[model samples]
Target: MRMTISTHDHVLIIDDHELVGTSLMLSLRSEGLRADWRGNAGGEEGILADVRRLDPGLVLLDLDLGRDRDGRMLDGVHLVAPLIDAGWRVLVLSGSSDRVRIGGALADGALAWVPKNAPLPALLRSVRAAAQGRPVMAPERRQQLIDTYHEQTTARSELRARLDKLTQREREVLAELAQGHRAQAVAERFVVSLATVRTQIRAILVKLEVSSQLEAVALYRRASGR
Candidate 1:
């Protein structure tokens, strides 16, 4: 049986599948918690409207918002940043097992990512913990996030050190190249001669220790976090 949710319901779920949403809603109700579900058709504006109307304490979100008319999966990552900015506590419940996707969601401020296949009791524990504003990452996932963070930090530091070797003019030239500007366009933009721009490009490659202009640009983007 379906439960009638009121504004006092503290939990709202956003999922693409009606069956899954209904089932989860029923399960949460059985635990004496009021909950409601929204389908993908609600869109971001609709979801925000619901949030405003419900004032839910916690939102369980799915990352995949279902397929488009062309059958491509609609990404829901874009919704995460705005939800975070709006002060919504989100817990991601998804079938996706991709570490990068899970990590990105958490990095984007999701409270937790509970694998859909996890035991119902475990999922309930995560929900309760999130509702209470507690840390919800499992041990293994926490370690994985830590390792990923360390790797990114190390890579960024190295890239910064390499970039530091470039002169101001060379850095400017590299920035232009990173934006897909050709040598001629960079020279024109900087009001420098083509030969001078080429010279700066070569120096940028040497200082960045990259073999080609594209590699230098890639390094610049990595260092700048672009």
Candidate 2:
């Protein structure tokens, strides 16, 4: 069964790639919804300009721009803040399957991240759901994301509680670990021996119950709710 979009809303698409954005624009308009296409939507100045002009009810943002071999310049990750700041409902439309990227987008305030190749019907359904002020993650992909999100968030909360048990030195070491600093760097920052930093890190990891520093930091960020 196909889900129908509410016909009265306006959706704005910002993609540097012409084919993908234009195709969606035409298809959506054919379904009796208002759609507009912008050549690109990144950078502070350009985004501000479009926000003023389009005043769209919803925005579909492609995460990639022309910066790599694949022509991806500004990351979609970078846009999340600005869009949220402008009070626009945004959906990330990207080809990237990196869960961290998707999670980061969600953590940064995007309503959902829909793959570029999702079925037109599903995309429209997501757009409509978002327009109606509902949070909509892709149904087929929701469970895995939900599980991972919960795990990361829970681990972070647990880490924060353990940090309360640590001394100020231990916390400084933990903060360094969360920032991806090496033991030697942490030692330098704290003016301690490298071995001391390593020991503190070991204690922190054990206390946090996380196997790796990356996971630890991910947990910490989730716990901070930032």
Candidate 3:
């Protein structure tokens, strides 16, 4: 079903999966609400443009919108503040279990969260509530999610600062290691001796304050979102 609504009372569903998005939109329509959906088939700019045009009452945003056509990751959380600033109320509806990302969206002015796997009745009710400007998420749970996001973001900043201590070559070497490449392979790829690679690896360890290559790689993945 397709809808073209310019009213502020409409609901918008921003999700990557077509089946999920379309089904949810249809369900909302069944309950006598105007709902629209934007998928990752288009670029971020296109999605936001359509959203601005719709000017919906509530946005059911997915935290993970997979990737765009250019292979760049497209997350709905990135749209939270932009939409909120434009006078839109957002309600996150996603399958992502990452509390940090969820909390980040909530902190960015989302009204509440409803799991993608939630039962149909519950999901519809939550959508209806959010469209009416009521948060479906519990207060304590909302605060907890917001706090987790802040804590994780702060820790990631500190980790990023430590990573900034690495030299250009050291950062490249760590990137290879983080991909599970052996130090020798990294040395070969960089056209350097194994000893030179070992030195770079040691520098990375010291800078990241990790005892093992695995720990350093984990930190790198966490900080870089790999």
RMSD of each: 6.8, 6.9, 3.4
> Of models 2 and 3, which has the larger lDDT?
3
> Candidate 2 residues 1-226, lDDT tens each?
4336666577888787889889999977886778888765455457657776655578888877545444446676777778777767788888877776677677677788888898988887877788878768755565566456667767766757866776788777767777778888888887989988778877777877778777767766666654
Among the numbered candidates, top lDDT falls to: 3
Give candidate 2 regions above 4 Å deviation: 1-8, 41-44, 68-72, 138-226
Clashing pairs in 3: none
lDDT of 2: 0.74
lDDT of each: 0.79, 0.74, 0.85
The alpha-carbon lDDT assigned to residue 143 of candidate 3 equals: 96
The C-alpha TM-scores of every prediction are 0.59, 0.57, 0.91
Residue 45 alpha-carbon offset, candidate 3, angstroms = 0.7
Clash list (residue pairs), candidate 1: none
lDDT, residue 148, model 2: 67
Top model by TM-score, which number? 3
Supply candidate 1's per-residue lDDT for 102. Answer: 65
Off by over 4 Å in 1: 1-9, 68-72, 146-226
